[model samples]
Target chain A: MLIRELERLENLLQPWREFEYINREVFRTLSPVQVEFPLVNLWKNEDKVVVTTEMPGVESEGVEINVTGKTITLRFERKPEELKDGEAYTRRERRYGEFKRTIELPFNVQSDKVEAKFSKGILYIELPRAEAEKPRKITVKSE
Target chain B: MAETVKDKNRENRKIYAPAVDIIETTNNILLFADMPGVNEKTVDVTVEKNLLTIHGMIEPTIDDKLTLVFSEYGSGDYQRVFSLTDEIDKNNIKATVRNGVLKLVLPKTEKIKTRKIEVSGEA
Candidate 1:
């Protein structure tokens, strides 16, 4: 009797499973796979290098930043929006998932001194050049 | 149904059509738009007649003193338009911006029957 009841429940859920499959196919066709997420911009001055990336609707706690020598890695996860019963999405274009990106800087940075700030869903990171890596200026005196 | 319309005003800065998700319930519609770097003061939403428009202005990240060494994306403003129908109560629309995302709630107008018509049989 238990086996027969489980089979009946499965039959009832068959249509919902097919609907989920169709939904996945529709989303795949609308948006293609991208190699990178949260694309970044890098800026440099004499003192430090600044990196910025836009990640709207993401919490600061979900982001992880790591710096090793001249390389920096960013890892983050965007949580999916939840829907209540009877609510349906008419159109969807936002992308959400776990993303990881590694970037190489021009020179070694002060890993311990790196400063990062999140404001208005934009991540700003300032990596100061290591004291030993920066070029030193020397003066010459003629007698 | 919502349809996008082109804006007549053109500026030097590039304007992007921000990605949006539209959800519908029995009583109202919800819209979420991603416009990074835009805050409440910089974002604007207006409804005129049957048209609704959204605009968000973002400041440039780089200045003259700094050289952009590497970039994978371009900076721009956000603008999108949608044609609304009479079903939506435009006067009661509510909007908010948080974490660079805009959320809009459009309430559905109440259905009203102005008059009842009677049918008569003809000879």
Candidate 2:
């Protein structure tokens, strides 16, 4: 009797699970709103501004970084994986395509001295502050 | 293993559900999960009794001296779980991490065959 009851409960719950999966799939595919791509974070101290962004599945060689004055631009391309002869994607939530992002800093940056590194699909950039933009410590002489 | 230790430390930390893409072939199912900032050392994949779980730990990349000026995305650990059917070969499942993406290949134990039956009319 216990085994029969358990089987009956399983049969009842199976459709609910399938319904939930289908609901999620429809909502994700039909939603028109989209979030901004390649989200970034910026940090600063005294000498330089550090920026980071996550780009999973992207290689280092495909990324391009440009710095002009206080502005930094990042460009990259994420290619979609090709399916084999009999393979088909049942669910696809990851985005893939060409992407470009531009960031402006509050202070001027040394464009030539800017450095960037890519590892494990994360982009790290350091933009040194321009010499003229550095905060100068004013000395108060005893009068 | 180290998995238990990390799970204990996850009390106050936020966990994010990483986006994934799942593909199905004739003999295998493939799953790709995006988990940036997690490398091989911090990722754990396990399967027990038809339950598959994926966990990836992330260490803060920003230095202590640096103050966040602007932000858009939050850094956190990634975790997801899925239920598997008995048709999958659980013992032979393979997982690999590359460029912050985790790929899991689950092979089916047997091919699902379709049989067509022929009907004969009695004379």
Q: Which one wins on DockQ? A: 2
Q: Could you give candidate 1's per-residue lDDT for residues A4-98 as a string of tens digits?
A: 01222332456643464466558677767753678899999887899999899999989999999999999999876788987788888788989
CA-lDDT, candidates in order: 0.81, 0.82
lDDT of 2 by residue, B1-123 (tens): 798887677765766667888888777888899999988999999887877888898998888998999998888787777778777788999999999899999887764422347999999
CA RMSD, predictions in order: 13.7, 7.4
| lDDT score for candidate 2 against the true structure | 0.82
Report clashes for each candidate as comma-separated counts.
0, 0
The fraction of reference interface contacts (C-alpha pairs within 8 A across chains A and B) present in each candidate is 0.75, 0.76
Question: What does DockQ come to for candidate 2?
Answer: 0.46
- Highest lDDT against the true fold, candidate: 2
TM-score of each: 0.78, 0.82
